[model samples]
Target chain A: MKTALRPSVALLLIAGILGLVALAFAWAGGWLSPRRIGGAAIADALQDNLGKPEPGWRRAHAKGLCVSGYFDANGTGTALSRAALFPAGRIPVTGRFSLGGGDPLAGDGRNVFHSMALLFRLPDGEQWRMAMDHTPIFPVATPADFVSLQIAGIPDPATHKPDPAKLQAYLAGHPETKAFMDYMKSAPLPSSFANGTYYSINAFRFVDAGGASRAVRWQFEPEAPFAALDKKTLDAQPRDFLFVDALKRLSAGPMRWHMIVVLANPGDRTDNATIPWGAGHRRVDVGTLTLDRAATEAAGDCRDYNFDPLVLPRGVTASDDPLLPARSAAYSASFRRRAIEGPRPDALTQAGEGGAK
Target chain B: MNGPDTLFAFPARLLHWTMAVLILAMLFIGAGMVSTVSAAYPALLAWHRPLGIAILVLALVRLAVRLTHRPPPLPADLPPIQAAAARVSHYLLYALMIAMPLIGWAMQSAGGYPVILWKGVALFPILPHDIVAYGWLRRLHGLLGYAFFLLILGHVGAALVHGLIRRDGVFRSMAGRGG
Candidate 1:
């Protein structure tokens, strides 16, 4: 094809050159190695889907209330995990309860996520952070898919709403999304933050004294009874009703949850966050978590925290769930962005006016 | 034109140009990172972390090369003060190149943040976690970053003075052509 080269030889040379260029790009982009999906990309993807990111607010679950308390371990967990908190003592804890959405000003309403994120302060300066949603599992399987879902959810500028056709195409390819949707629609709406079971959907390795590691997932099973949420009552409540309700409930008495760990039976997938382990798996009640006080996020102990799901203790190790690292990176990116953005504007406005706490 | 005696070792020239390009990119990326809350921060940070470590490694090698094989002398007519300034500035550049990455590693360690170069490869924490220490180190890193930029400006000025104005071989020695 060329002036001096045969057709096949020329094609091979072109292909070789193209391949080398691709290799060079891969090396630079970290594709040649186990380069992660960039946290900034995923974080931006989420903010894009969520609309304009609020200054000094989380990119997701922006509206939240912080709580302080302790975890009373009954020693039942020591059989599975050698975490210092599992040694039957009251360990200091800080946590937050939030409604999922990017808008901190969004009202408490239906079809939104309710979540509890915790930081358990163990002995000798070790801390374990856990963020769990009311739902039993993550909506997607991997970090890349999560990013793709966020991109798919980006609003059409002309309509100011996500393109339904794009979402439908995404759902057709990802049955996991359909499964998550089905579960959401069929599952009883949480009546209150205290009433919902907060699940650590991703599997983790619980290492015991003998150095044996067991695949496990856990939930904070609430002491409060569950009841299907009444829609009319929910609609009538104020914008910050969830936070108000949580404070009200706490004022009367300390709220509690039992830390329950579910061990994987043989052949259960520890890597995939979307798959649910069979019901026959053994579960152990590990500890009791008690919340005694509530504080506004503006001045709360949890204010600057980034409740990354991958922050595990010495006894706890991350599983093959790729989303774990993705969560950590994205949360750090979000945290860094807000930290640079400075104090929340509402906090500043309130301070300027000498408003009541 | 650079005489054979004036030119640096071949390896030295290669490392110089390689590091010059990398360090300049690092400065711009660092500036972009703090100036915005955009989603692009993560990608910038990804490149920054690995690139910073690479600069550190290259700086160490370059220093070794310099120590073992002394650079060419300044021109015979050069002022003593100018020569001293060159010596001092070059040392400062090397120190900053080394210190910036070390401080970044320490800051991440103290803050209990991961120094993830890329997926699957994470740099080890060299310091214990202390939030207060992390805050102080972060401030120091920011301050040093500015100082490094200024030092680079002075360097480029010195190089240009020798190359274009004085027509000395100083710049040509490391320019990677007919030295």
Candidate 2:
């Protein structure tokens, strides 16, 4: 019983114990984790490269046309997800078709990234919102890389084009972009929005009622069929040809897309956004997305929504995809800015009433 | 190892101290995670999650060990009030050790965020995803986290008193050489 220890020694020992506890905590919490990146910072970086965003416009996809429709769940997805929307029912949907750019006036003649965002209203009053892209794979893997790519896109004031040196540096660091660039060279640019297959390139988990789960990615396979146009053919069309073409197509009847859920096999990369899942995987045609009424931002008010891909129903949840939360954070940041800016009637406000951009 | 009548079994002591460190870190990490939306949020979160599940697993093993190998009794000369306080506090600690992680897992599940530990590794949600459930579960998790923190302070404060001031073997029962 070495109670012969002095008061100062005892107090110092106690302090040492507490300090060691704190040290252990810090070592685990700080040493193993990555530096946090705020969504607002991502948005700021995006806007810095893309130009001052049009007031009330989305930070990533500014120019968009709204369409209202319904999703008819075919019950096939019920085997994959326990979500209420999958039980063979019709769910109301509000969708927006947009081009991925900061500028609302960016030429439609140039083949840029096309985006399809959807907001589905479930019977339980919960909303499922997702923003998908025309490409099967995202060009960049992480938010930092995404921002770096955006910075590479920034135009030099004198030259009005990105500095070749910066572009080269980005390519060297992110060969994923180089691969994406190679694919884009030969990839078909959709002649119309209705012709493109929009994908949720980031993976998610679909949990069935039996408590089973699977890693999956989903896409809207167009019923209109795939049609690709060359740059020269696209450049010959009108400046607002994409939107004009959508309007003309909607005049016929409701446009349709099959919701195909692509299953991931064991060992497939779930955290990566740059790699598309290879073929020979099981695909489930889960539902049908029927887009009927087309409207502009003023009329459809798709501008009022965030379309955060993380907004999922009960049966679905985010996977280990690193980009999923980053995308969500960036979307939240962009949405927060739009909330502060307030909705403003843009040049396309009269588009629903037969006006031009 | 000391007899069960003297000190806790070695595995029990090891788990107690190891979990002591993990739980302390978890509490602070949880605090930092909620208090900010800073760039460190995700990093803090990454640590918070794995640590939580680890604590839960350790808690289960600790519980089994405790049930099978009874803890040594308090000192014979201890005052009645202090002994009762010891028993109650110890029980509460065990309850909290298990509850904290279970509640946290449910809260994250309700919020629709998967509790991912590593690349493609995750724990399934124990509860259904409902915003109302998520909202209340979140509040409950926050409340219990503070309660858990306060209990640790009392536990540590008393252990110091027994070791430094009172010079009782109670502190040594878990912290020192074979009792």
Q: Identify the leading candidate in terms of DockQ.
A: 1
RMSD (CA, Å), each prediction: 8.9, 9.2
Task: Give the number of the best model, judged by lDDT.
Answer: 2
- Write one digit per residue (lDDT tens) for candidate 1, span A152-217: 889998888999998889899999988998888788888888889999978889999899999999
Q: What is the TM-score of chain B alone in each candidate?
A: 0.95, 0.93
Q: For candidate 2, state the interface root-mean-square deviation in angstroms to 1 decimal.
A: 8.1
Instruction: Give lDDT tens digits, candidate 2, residues B1-179.
Output: 24445777889999988998899878888765543334355567778888998999999999999999978888889999999999999999999999989988997676555556642356777887544465567677878887887788778878987878677778888885733
Candidate 2 docking DockQ = 0.07
Quote the positional error of residue B173 for candidate 2 in Å.
34
In order of appearance, the predictions have TM-scores of 0.70, 0.63
lDDT of 2 at A256: 95
Docking quality of model 1: it rates as incorrect
Give lDDT tens digits, candidate 2, residues A83-140: 7778898999988999888777666776678889998877544667889999988888
Chain A vs. native, model 2, TM-score: 0.87
Q: Please tell me which predicted candidate would have the highest TM-score against the true structure.
A: 1
Worst 10 residues of 1 chain A by lDDT: A346-355
